[model samples]
Target: MKDRFVANQNAHLEMVLQQMTERLLQATSRLMARQGRPPQCNYEKKQNVWSLATSRRHCVE
Candidate 1:
């Protein structure tokens, strides 16, 4: 029973992380657009799932 509970908890955590990552990406894209720049997003994998690695914008003057 404990093993099953742990598995369920992990799955739930992964789903929540994925949703948060998606929202972050959208907001980052919008912000970059407003600033006339583009976002360079990177994804990293953790425990067989991809998560938001970094959000960066390049500024050219």
Candidate 2:
């Protein structure tokens, strides 16, 4: 049970980090757009970004 908890916590941390990275990337992209520069992500254009990596935009994906 202790090991399982540790594993679960690690997974949650990784997921959180991934979500933050995606948000930063998108925000950086948008900032660059306003500065007359292009984004480096090259993510496929979607009607909305509610799905940066997973299909949810909540703080944790």
Candidate 3:
């Protein structure tokens, strides 16, 4: 029963994480759209996991 409970909790956590990721991406897209520029993405490796970092470049034009 304990293993079942743990499995259920893990599933819930994964679902919540996925939802958060989707929301973040949506917000980022909207922000870029409003700014009228695409974000520059950088990938950094940390603890064997790759994560994305984004920055908006100041347009000189």
Candidate 4:
């Protein structure tokens, strides 16, 4: 009986973990989409400003 209970608990934990992982992936995708692809610029001023704007837009979205 104890072993069975442990197994059940483990299964429940696994399900919770899976759900958490799915949510995390979804959040990551949304973030990436909002941020768009990485900047192509190599200069500091453009890259910094662009990245800041992307982050701000993501927050608004």
Query: Which candidate tops lDDT?
Result: 2
Best-to-worst TM-score order: 2, 1, 3, 4
TM per candidate: 0.64, 0.65, 0.61, 0.60
lDDT of 1 by residue, 1-61 (tens): 9998986896687679778876777787788889998666533333224422321111211
Best TM-score goes to which candidate? Answer: 2
Q: Which residue pairs overlap in candidate 4's backbone? A: none
* Candidate 2: segments with Cα more than 4 A from true spot: 44-61
Writing each residue's lDDT as its tens digit, candidate 3 over 1-61 gives 9998986896687568656766676677678879997755321222113122211111221
What tens digits encode model 4's per-residue C-alpha lDDT throughout 1-61?
9998986896687568656755665566566668985434334454466557656855775
Candidate 1 residues lying further than 4 Å off, grouped into runs, are 42-61
Q: Which regions in candidate 4 have their CA more than 4 angstroms from the true location?
A: 38-61
RMSD of each: 11.9, 6.7, 13.3, 14.7
As for model 1, its CA RMSD to the true structure in angstroms is 11.9
lDDT of 2 by residue, 1-61 (tens): 9998986897798678767866777788899999998876664453134355344534563
Candidate 1 local lDDT, residue 10: 69
Q: TM-score of predicted model 4? A: 0.60
TM-score of 1: 0.64
